[model samples]
Structures are given as structure tokens and as C-alpha cells.
Target: MGKYEKKLKEMVFRLGYFTRNWRQIVHLALATEHFGVNNRTYSPDFSLFGKRGPGKFLGIPERIRMMRARAFMGFIPLKDAVRLFPGYAARHGYLKGEENSGD
Candidate 1:
């Protein structure tokens, strides 16, 4: 691979490592508090994701896979997301804000 590609790959790997390690640390802390082994009482805030209903819990591997799939599906880069809408507008002959106009 070229120098730039190699550098980019290294950067991505470092970023992934940092993110994974951070999550693991957070999970460990949560688990410790969850089991009530700590001297202080701790309560988990589940309101962010809503109630934890019955379902298969996703471990780190599954979470990473899902993140990778989402990244591959053009979910990144807000600037590029606008490109996706132009084609549909061309096909329908509709400008963005003038959708209500008869013209």
C-alpha cells in the first residue's frame, strides 16, 4: 500500500483501540457499581437508552461489527449525506424549498 494509505490505516487502528479501551473501562466501572461491591452506593442511569427489555445482550464484538457496518453504509460525513438527496430531487423535478409550488 501507499504511504498515505498505511498512515490512514494506522490512524484508524489507533482510534478504534482508544474507543474500545474507553468503553471497556466504562463498562468495568458500571459493573463494579452494579454489583454493589464498592463502598459507595451507585445507581445506573438507564433512562438514556430506555428500559432494558428482554433481548440478547450485545458484547464488544457485536457492537464493533455493528459500528463498522454502519460506517460502511455511508452514515458518516454529514457533507456527503446531502449528495444523496440531489439525485432524488432531479428525478422528481423538485427543488428543496419549493416543493409546495405548483411549478
Candidate 2:
């Protein structure tokens, strides 16, 4: 409805066309002010900031699935995944140096 919301919607749409890398998502979220920083923790409102309808609507799950598929198919290297999605990778125990161990 507002300028930032419109921008975020557009970004999410664009992201759906691409790889949906977490790094990109986080960056966009932060850039569009959809992400809030709280004592080293990030709060992202994916519902509003994520892709809309037609298929895998909420985007984040679909993006994660895509990432997993890419990793499984060797399209993405583990190190790259770690680099691109450190928070997700660490939370899922796919990488070391996780800030929060619990999911």
C-alpha cells in the first residue's frame, strides 16, 4: 500500500524469478526496511515481503526448497550455501558457527 511495501512486493516478485538466495532476500528486506534489527537478531515479515500467489505463494519455503534442491543436485556448493544462507544453514545445522542452535 505504501511506497516501501510496493517496493518490497516488486523485489519479492523479482526474487521469485531468480534463485531466491537468502543473502539476496535478506539484503532486499533490509534495503526495503522490511527487516527489523533487534540485538543481533533479524525479524523479517515474509508474509508482506514475500512473493504473492499463483504457485508457491509465501516464497520463503519455496526458496528454501529450491536451495535444498540446488544443494542436493550439486548446483550449489556447500560453502556457497553457507555463505549465501549462513543463518538458515546454521539454524539447520548444515554449517558450523551457528549463532542460535535451536530451530
Candidate 3:
């Protein structure tokens, strides 16, 4: 019904885990391969409330919706988590069979 809800629906479908009916809630985590450091790190922002909500019964769908909304904001200027685009793409499966393809 809202923007976050809509985004959540799109992501769920994109990850190849779509549910046929509306009432059916197939709660699960997506396997995200983030592009960056040598140590592989999955998309940590997909959780219900990593740093947002805790002990909140907002439902799995709602949680995902919020996460999707935050993702739209793009990578923030976090000094600790920042990295070059080429390295990022390479780690995130965006590289087309080449190291640092974005370059």
C-alpha cells in the first residue's frame, strides 16, 4: 500500500523468491554477494532491524519494505564502509568476468 511495501514486493520477486498468493508470507533471507574487500560480505541491510528496529513486531514484509527503502538512499558517506566503485562492483557480482570491470 505504501512506498516501502511496494519496494519490498519488487525485491522479493527480483531475488527469485516470489510467492503466488498475497496471504502467503515466505519469509527468508536473500543471498547477496557485496563487492568490496577480500572477505566476502553479503548484503547486511536486508534484515528486519539490524540497526533500525529491535523487538518490534512489524512483520517480515514490513521489515523488508523498510530495508528496501533504505537501500534506495545508496551507500552513505560512511568512512568505515566506503570503497571504490570498481572494487565494489567486483565483489558484488557486477564484474563481467573481469577484475574491477567498472574501471
Best by lDDT: 2
Clashes of 3: 2
C-alpha RMSD in Å of predicted model 3 compared with the true structure: 15.5
Please, what is the whole-model Cα lDDT of each candidate in the order they appear? 0.40, 0.49, 0.37
Q: What are the per-model C-alpha RMSD values against the true structure?
A: 13.0, 16.3, 15.5
Per-model TM values vs. the true structure: 0.27, 0.32, 0.22
Maximum-TM-score candidate: 2
lDDT (Cα, tens digit) per residue for candidate 3, span 1-103: 9968855654655344223321222222221223211222344334432323432444555655543333334632222111223345466554558655231
Worst 10 residues of 3 by lDDT: 22-31
Tens-digit lDDT track of model 1 for 1-103: 9968855765675566546455433433333323222222344532222223332243445544444344335654433322323334334543455332120
- The sequence of per-residue lDDT tens digits that candidate 2 reaches over residues 1-103 is 9968855765665456345445444533333233422212255654343333543344556565564546535655677555444456766677656463221
Backbone clash numbers for all candidates listed: 0, 0, 2
